[model samples]
Target: MLPDPIHILKTVYGYDAFRGRQAEIVRHVMAGNNAFVLMPTGGGKSLCYQIPALARPGMGLVVSPLIALMADQVAALRQAGVRAAALNSDLPGEERRALWRDIRGGTLDLLYVAPETLLKPDVVDRLATVPLSLIAIDEAHCLSQWGHDFRPSYRQLDALVARFPDTPRMALTATADTPTRAEILAHLNIAESDAFIADFDRPNIRYAIQEKDNPRAQLKRFLMDHEGESGIVYCLSKRRTEETAAWLCAQGYDALAYHGGMDKAAREANQARFQHGEAIIMVATIAFGMGIDKPDVRFVAHIDLPGSIEAYYQETGRAGRDGLPADALMLYGMEDIALRTRFIEESEAPDQRKRMERQKLDSLLGLTETAGCRRQALLSYFGDRCQPCGNCDTCAEPPHLFDGTIAAQKALSCIYRTGERFGQAYVVDVLVGAEDERIASFGHDRLSTYGIGKEHDKRTWRAILRQLIALRLVDVDLSGHGGLSIAEDGRDFLRDKATLMLRVPAAPRPARGKLAHRQASTALPEADRDLFQALREKRMEIARLQNVPPYVIFHDRTLIELAAARPASRADMAAVAGVGEAKLTRYGPAFLAVIAEHGKGLRA
Candidate 1:
């Protein structure tokens, strides 16, 4: 068993050892047992099943959610010299027929198909006649009703358990809380004990949340460090994605816009360019995320707050897939919260689901305002714990805590005095003693609570209100119109004269001018830095010619290792972590030439 998995890992995938629970998972799956894998984005979830498919005697069926994902994975596996192919609508009729023939003939070790395709009875019946090894359901969280990436097609996969009762089955996902995990277990008929939840912390990712003051400027400054790197900028709306992408490009960055609203050709073209080219920034909606397998996305930025912590975690997980240092930044404000709240309120989902969504949103806000470690707070939400990572925004510049009991009382009283039917703007105007027509029309300028908050500017009051909303002391009532109303706790607090503590949002800091700043001297020596860049150039050229992502050729980490070690011969090159026999033979001489030139430089 060790020989099989190790052989597959080193010879096929080019990794010398399994990182986490991957070895255990491969062994369990190969033994023909049911499995439920909850691993991180770059945690090698695919290897758990891919290895078994090779060591096992029958064809492995992978139930994937998207055609693009299937095609991409298939292309990647094929490049590694594996017998893999995807049967999806993207294939022509003849191709599909021929793929089925290959499946029937047992020529393909791995067969990737979408859930809808696999659910067809004829397809199931056809598979029953073939030599079946094991079945894997990728992105299994899509089956959960409460999951952010829910797909009705994944729920239909329950039928596969009954159809392939004798065969081993696996359901894998990267994003699921306790409830969603239970649902996936029940829906997929996997036992509770068989489930594997690997650690959720992507330590290589440094998290930051800015207050969104001058968000465009903040984003521009943030991108200064990550210039000449691949990344994704997530926005709340399609219009924002397009606008941000256009603005970034105009500012001299290569950027692309991707959203569901875009035509297929446009989305595909952008995705391809981002995948194949270096130094590309993709501004996309949540729709552009799930299937992206790029490993060197150095940063991920959110122009707006996401709908849930789950969505935020999943989106940010897209960065630093290769375990290299990366960054995650979000620019959020009170409006982002209010708009996210409105979306949850307007959702046709059941009241219970809406309540859960609101709770999730509040959790995200709590992280933004946390006075402690951001990574610790985020992991705690998922039921994991660790010491302060000292790598996130909060850990860097701790939020200043202020006793806001007086401010809270003032804001809540204003909400109550204003009839709880007005928006925050109106409430703010009344509080700040702005004699506007709306306030005068309502005669609220005469209220006792009016001008009580004049001691604090409108921005200060808004910050207090934002904290109140986050604390559930004030809840946005969306029954008739979007209005600010005191929560049950707000009334209790006022009646009991409770003290409130709030965090002062960090002020926007001036950019360190990282692009102008030299690269960190620690990644490689100054002398080898030039050699590393040459290696990257060669990697990009190979990727473009081969029509694959650059990382597929060699991850940046591997290149860093190559530059540091300057492997002198083919054997030494194979000793590098990512260099397996297939890649070593195909491209070893080319890389060796580059290294030899560096050796010449050193000799000179």
Candidate 2:
């Protein structure tokens, strides 16, 4: 029903093929069927609409939320020789009018606008006259109530579908769980549209959650390990962002800070430095996550725990967008939980919204406390199954757990000896056989078990204390200024009737570069080696233009296989392992063209 899109691959977009279901979605959009795309953060969601916009007869309307993102996407599309323009609040009146004229003149392939602009009756009236082919909604998750970053203006998006009932529509977002997905479809009035859900697992990233104590030192060590690699350090406060960024800079790393507290101009400048790769580290708050298009982020570290798993996932998803190995680390403490809870409780949200926020908070706490595989716990929370990522901190240095029956008794005795009202420092002081003035004043020096654990070092004893708290053997008095008290379980341990396994912390290892690509095969013929690199570069360029991860455009494994087989036709392309009808139809010809070009060069 549509013209062959083969030329799009070579002439305009410069890609040899479509990855995953992109071509199918393109065809579906061109045929005027509504679509809902549930791709990951770095997946090629743009090509679905971009290719169709070029192939179809009329201009495609893309509705996006962020001004910076829309501007960046429009610039990239123009570089690829596609006619695109964005209309938003930031555009001057003359510039906006000119863009509208371009759209009406049939010169623009795609038009991007903010949802607020689309809500104006006058704007909708103008759009009604254009020969619109398709409507694309970016960040569709913002429409869902279950989503962490829900925007009220997004509720008006469904009206666009109503205005042009005959126009095909597609909605896409990176981080949406099943509930959020359902909400997106319901809100958009497209529950029955064809849905494309890509794989949620980002196997290239390793997940880590460490107990918070001296978090700044831990962060420094993490940065030192991954030095020179691009990373983001997330902090809960603006002050912390500035301080951390300054500290990293002092330590001889290229670092910058970004937060809402900074002036608009300064924030923009910092963001530019980061995007251009001039700054390898960005210490920021939640404001930095949504519109960042960087793909080579090697690590995402949380200096403080996020309030929820959704926030954590969305923030960490920024890393490894290139489908390369990345790391996600979280440092947590009792103060973090208290801070998060107080912040939530003081919010002005409705009761229902408050309840939802609490549920999300509980999920994050579970993530921090879980002793199981970090990746499994994370994916399971999002309603997916995943095995332990063998490269994570837990798998790399599996915790050394020892029977804590005796140690638990000693810890409980110390807490009891201190009248169960003192903090950890005092308890540790009493346990380590210290007879300082503070201990002597409270008669803790006279307790029978005061010197029982003196043989172990302070660090070892501290780990035991953490284990006690983690296992609920010791109750942290949340309302009592964080004092330590014996729990019911601690009483049982002291009676010598309970068994415990206390983990001894290991020395942190220097950060090492990720292992070489084990996902690719070594069996490629020597003749095709040059072709392989060419194909990968092409993939990378396409990824850069579309603002997606390289693997989502076309996986490295798929590219390697294509080089080996040298698929020379549509049918040949369809035979590749990951290639399907969507990809073959969208990218087959472009791929054939690349091989043809390379073949001629070799012959010459």
Candidate 3:
């Protein structure tokens, strides 16, 4: 019989117990069964498959999407003494030959391959000769066309099911809505009964959404809370990424830009730098963070809107992967929504797909405009519910609501009276009776709804209009120009004189000076702070020497534990969390020496 999984977990991985459904999924896979896993990012999804792969008889084959992701996982596994390797186009001839030798020699435990490389005829034929333990598809949502990050190559993976009929298979992803989940299950030939769905809440990430008002200023303020920390600032466009990165550098931040538009070498080098260095801010587009494995991202800020909630969740989920306190701050405005809608309407996707995209956009807009707990609204999108989490902006400072019936009527009537041909700026201008030449030339200056909305300022009127659009009381024209028209519901709302409650725009919250920074460092006592820093320096030094990311050797959490516990001997260090046998043997003595020196210094 195979060794006990718990024994493998403690001895090989150094975790005391499995988290959530990890143990159950491992057992199911180990029993030669297929499974689908939907867990949040940083929810120990890797262990669910890694443990089974170790305990099973043959080498496990993992299908990953990105080379960086595969390389990082392989590095971490090797550091833990697992014979893991990856096959990708980036591998040199000698390395590729050696990896195949290991695979044929039955010396590899887990092998991660890209879908494209694995699907090649020669690779498949070669793999067919080897005894396989299990097949795992990470980032499995890419198989679903409905998913935000769909890849056509993922659809071709069904061939694996037919080719490896007896080997157990599992599909895993961190962000998949209901439809995406069903698509993955259907495409992978996994039974519904075998799926494990965990709660889609990341309670550790404090969610904050603000209406875009001087976005650069807002982003800078958010960054103040995360000073000297590693974070990602996502922009909507490649140009914006470069500009933001440059601006951040001007402000004395160690910032770098990464996007598809950059040269390949530069992009890879920037990613490598961000991965290996601490306190570096990476300003990037959506192209940057699909399968990143960094564990200590303290914040994820989006200066522009993401495509959907799944995209938003996946991007923000990158932060605090080590389960520490982190922040997800997003800033959006009317232009962002219009741009997203225009992209959807102009896309070549089928009508059904377009409708689904519109619905997803609507859901995301609702999240942005929600006056309730952001977490509750976010979870509700995934068919999960939670109590009003005190961790979000609304829960911390609830927005004030006002009777928006009159304001809505005036805004909708202005759009209707103007023949619904104008965009938001013209409508707002007409409402506030601006002395603009276009208003007079269009004869909208004399309309009954012209100056009637003067009770609210231009900013307030814009907010009202946005809330109307979010509520489906108004429709944005998809004709490349952002014209506003009253929806059927808006007509009824106007006719029936319905009451509407809209949020009064709240001022941006001030930076919680050193609060976030303190939370990250507070695990160590005042006396242990120096030791923690020293340990971190040592980790960085060793990581640089090996040319690998620091976390591959040990995570910040493990370092914090060492500083607090000050493990005196090899046995004591081995007992610490994240210190498995391989890591203890390789890294324990070095860490213990640091602790010993720190102790001597204290005595002195």
Candidate 4:
């Protein structure tokens, strides 16, 4: 008979209870059934598989995508006292042999392998000899071509499934839309009835998006709220990442640049620093953040737009994995939209796929342009819904909306009168009656729509045009000199004389004073703050000695519990959440001593 799952959760993993659907999923998997889990980041997806792996009779095999992710999970599991090991290219010769021996000897509880490594014939033959408890495919969204981060290697996982037909299989991902989920189910042969879809809301994260104006200044203002905290700043280009990192360093911030173009060793070193240190900011392109398991990233800032809502959701979901207050800020403008559209139009995909991409882009634009709650719109894209979350920028300070039909008419008429050949700058100039040579050269000065928009300034006129483009009333001609033209919707609106509402561009707010140090520390009382820092220092010291990320030793959440409860004995510490039998036995004394020291000092 198998051990009880709650026993493993309490003694091996140290969680008081299973979170939403985790208990159900665990029970189902342990019953020798397959499952497809769609949980958000930090939603305890790993625990859903890990607990069952320990409870079941034989070894559990996990298929992971990246080596770093596998290594991180292995380290954390071993620290928690579970017999976990990752079979990857990074292991030394003797270490690999020992792991294989343990696997063949039935001494390993769980093993993580990259898809490439697991697909090898020799490895498959070796694994066929051992009895397997279950198989889990992590980041299962990669199997769907409709997903934002599709991997062809994941499609080939069907071979492994065919080989291990008797093993109960589970597929897991944090990001997948309706179509992506359907495709994943079809590819994995997992029945729809077995899928467990959780709510996609990350209430701990505050969403905010701003129109790109003085991007550097805007980013600086955003950073003021997140001082002395670890975060990621994503840029669209490698040059931008390096430049932004250098600029941040000049401003006295410890920033590092990471991109695919950098030397492999250098990129790895930068990633290592960001993972191990608490205050470093990593300026990177999209190449950096897949499968990162860091739980304390305080913020994720985007200086440019992502291609789709899936990409945005996946990238922004990296922050606040510890379920603490975090921030997601994005600055986008008209150019970002045009560039993304050009990318879709220029891709080699089939027409149907291109149409799907266009629809996805439209959904993302709707998210950015929505006057309602950002979270609500974001969740709605994935076929989820919630009440208006008060944490996003739109909820905090709602934008003013006014009838913009007249303004849109003026802008579209100006484009039409000018032969729809000029870009936004030239078109705006013509609308606001600029005495420029280009307008005169194009004979636009004689047009009736030239001076009709003088009531609004150039900035307002440009804002109106951008809104029109976002509303699909105007189309950007990317094939020719980035010209402006009327879309079918624009023509229909003009013919119908339809009324429209547009948001008033918000003026930039003055940067507020620095807030509290860190969310973790601020949550504790003043008296316990010192103890929390001391505990963090101890965790870092131990982590450095062990050459693992500090979070692997003890998460900030665990430290907060220690500081708050001030457990005086090993038994007391063991009762704390996240303190499994292995951890309590390993580091309980050291932490208890720190608490004792703090207590004595307080008495004095």
Candidate 5:
């Protein structure tokens, strides 16, 4: 009744093998068993369902969340020679009617519909008449009540399970924590035995977090290695987004601002341009990146701290969807932490909700201040484990670790003697023996704790305070004036029940070399750099002709393979990975010609 999954993958999609749990998920779904999948963005999550869709007997119905994402995915699937169609509100009436005809005629291998569309009674009535081999729900995290992209339409999808009890169902997402994963399974009635949680590691993404210092200058330094590349810069507020975009534009970068407050038409146009153009940077709020299907985004930088690790993972994951090396950088400061703490305490969000939000914020703060592997801490939040990744800033250039036992006690003593009602600045000033008016007026200068920390500079003292806050030794009270109060844990440290080891606030490490991840794409010899650039230019030229993302034509990994292997002809190109019959037939000659001109000593 169907072709083999491996056969469809190679012959249609051009990939030779499945990575990690993809093959296993494909097999399970193909056998009509339900599955809940959690894979990172650009980890080939689509293939797990696409391959089975091709192998199954009837159309594979996909419930996607956004109209843009549905269109983007359908376009890419068609480019790979798969029969795909998207039925959404964006389609013209005639086109919708025609697609319905095709669906009823059973001509489509895959049909992508918005959850809103699928939940319509009439639309459901229409789709039920056709045979569906399997159901795939993309961005399944939205189904959860507490998920970042929660939508109520997903709540009604449970009817699909009741309606088609015999049909296999698969829920998929790139970013979902353990709670979200459990919710997805429970909502879809997918047993835990069928849930496949792939390693939450995006090994292609090099993670780095820096304390905010001269943010504009620091952002420029981070952007230096990534010049002329496609990336995103996230700001916390709409005003910041607009200002940063304008500043980047004035600085001669091709940048645009996107936020909910913008005109609807303008927003849609900007989204299209970013999706289609290369080397364009979008400075946006958290609103811009959900379900973005672009594959060639090289980096995602944040100018402020995100609310949670799940939010951070989902936003930064917009980069490197092609499995090529990418970068994730964030600049956060003590002010940001204090502001977030204040908001959590004062906001009208339910007490339980605020508490949970504060807990999530603490987790992200822990990740930001971690002197060890950021990736390991990040993955651990999702109930995954990984070794120290050498790609992160901490693993790349470890900070100076020093025994801060005395420094901790000094800061704590200052908070204690000053009545624990002063802001961190006042406390730090008291420790550093500052003769400020507040210190003189409050007689803090007369205290014995004053001037005890004269050996360390203000910056060092601030680092100690920040680390103390991160370790929960010092709590920043928002409701009772912004002041430092000793947490229960801080009392232990003050009494010598615990020792303090703090990382010195080191000067900023320069961004890693261009070949940072130095994986498949960047591992080429220095001699091959020019050739790779030429290949990329040629790919762009071809993409302009086809009106698709260059990656949709051929991924950067494919070009790197070509540059390394230096294939001499179409026949030779067939040996390279990602060269299926359809793609090679379409793009092989052009890329081969570029390689022939630039590369010598071709691989036989």
Candidate 6:
């Protein structure tokens, strides 16, 4: 009959409302029902489980795979004054024992552990005896073999869950398609749990794909455009991460490199520096993103194409976590595609796995080349509909397009004439009528296809060649491997069996200034942003006391909008977006109380 923990959220967390399905998800779990949350990067996924853990009578068991993530989450929760502890191998044995004792004594609200630890025979036996209100899996996608960041250890989770079937369980991830989602359910044997799918659209990120010529120069230009803004640069190799980080530092930016190859001490040091805002850029391999909770990353760049769209989404999702404008830039070429294929071809994974990988790669390529709205394509892949976001490069500056049917025929004929042994540069030479020594050595000057397309400039021919490759009309011979070969589509074009329409590369636009100032100008004043955060902290406390997600009382953006507008009365508050009748009736007094208190102090 009591109002439950919703009042706690209003008083403690300073939130007057819930955003999206957070309240629904929280209730299902709090009532001892199982849940599976599919929220995007900045979708407030943590609170779906964290709030119930605090409000519930017993400690919440959180199974996290990474020590760094666990440490970060535990630190953040403690900072918010929640009683939390993590038991991991990184801690001293004595500390671990003490944590277990504390959990047993009901002194902790939440406890985080690695899945490996959860499966230990002794640990499982001990955990089974604890007063656990719920079991939560943080990165649940890792449990699926179909997932990009798959871990075999996560299979152990099923056994742990089997031991505590009566306890409520929730699995959460930022990226998972239908297949991976099903895999998580079946693997954990929780197929019937209530599923909450947050829309996958990242509205603030502008997606850009540039040809990777002079890649370092292109990267430098990108860094210059976003100087002093926070971002992550993902590299395919450790050496590249270090080199790029060093180069960024040389360019007078705060940059550091992180890879699994680094010593634990060094990696932690770099990660800590990045977390605390001491470094503006982190050049890292894939290991860097999993539990990264930094909310202000302005951009994410891939010097090469990632292996899958899911991986690409998860990586790029790390950017613009504050729901602000960010960029997702990829510099890709034929080599990146080949590299990814080689990985799939050489891996010991089963055929199904290989096929899945290929499908994901193809989806990523589709993203790079699609002429329609990029965000729409990305969201549609995850089963969400969206109008053009009007934010990405394709939306802001749509590419110029040309009919490339004739160009395709000419290029395909050149490749066939060259015996499919020549790469783009050599082919470009023949098309541009360049009778260089390399062309002379190959006798390409004598070919019927040579000099036929000399009417176009070298740059024009190069653009046509790049577009052809992007459209998959021409295949690069993986053996000789850099050389050009007509793909099935190109052969069809040569035989008049198919027609190709290719996009004309748009003229490059000058880089704009960082959007940080514009962002700050639109939000709270520099001085009041901290105060706004304090007020939200108070709102979160209120929400927690009431046993609801913070947003159920007041969304963070609404609070920020209020802070910017500085509304004093219910009428003023009602005018703000997302603050409706119910929220006004319930939360107007508490929010006004904080505003009045802050105003009084300022006037004094």
Please, what are the lDDT tens digits per residue for candidate 1 over residues 1-604?
Answer: 3347898899887789998999999999888899999998888899999999889888999999887788778877876778999877678988889988999888998999998888888888999999878999998899999898899988888998888898889998888999899999998889988999999999888898877778889998888887788899999999999999999989999999999999999899998898888789999999887857888888999989887889999999999888887888898877788788888888899999988887888788888778899999999998999999877877776778888898888888889988888888888888889978878888998999888888878777777787888787888765646599889988999999977788775566666522132232237888888889999999988888888888778888889899989999999998898887788888899999999998898799
TM-score of each: 0.95, 0.78, 0.97, 0.97, 0.92, 0.86
Please write out the lDDT profile of model 6 over residues 276-379, one tens digit for every residue.
Answer: 55127999999898867776677899998887888989999998776867788888876777677678887899999888887887788888887888888888
User: Which candidate, 1 or 5, has the higher TM-score?
Assistant: 1
Where is model 5 more than 4 Å wrong at Cα?
346-352, 416-421, 441-443, 479-481, 491-497, 512-521, 596-604
Candidate 2 per-residue C-alpha lDDT over 133-215 given as tens digits, one digit per residue, 9 for 90 to 100: 78899888888877878888987888876789988888988778777888888877775548877766778788877877677
lDDT of residue 345 for candidate 1: 82
Error of 4 at 123 (Å): 1.5
Every candidate's lDDT = 0.86, 0.76, 0.91, 0.90, 0.85, 0.78
Candidate 3 vs. true structure, TM-score: 0.97
Summarize candidate 4's per-residue lDDT along 298-387 as a digit string, tens digits. Answer: 999999998799999999999999988888989988888888899999999999999999999999999998999999999998889999
Q: Which candidate achieves the best lDDT against the true structure?
A: 3
Put down candidate 5 lDDT per residue, 1-604, tens digits, no spaces.
Answer: 5578887777777778889999899998888899888898888888888888888888999999877778788877777777899998879999989999999999999999999889889999988889998999998998987676788999789899988898899899988877778888888999999988888888889988887777888888878877778899999899999999999999889999999999988988888889887789999998898889888899999998887889999999998887778889899877678777887788887887787787888889889888889899999998899888887888887778999888888888889999988887888888888879989998989999999999998878887888888888888877756788898999987676576788889776665543354444456887787888888899889778877767777777778888888898887898788888888888888888888877554443
TM-score of 2: 0.78
How would you encode candidate 3's per-residue C-alpha lDDT over 257-280 as one tens digit per residue? 999989999999999999998999
Query: What is every candidate's alpha-carbon RMSD to the true fold?
Result: 2.3, 6.3, 1.6, 1.7, 3.0, 5.9
Backbone clashes per model, in order? 0, 1, 0, 0, 0, 40
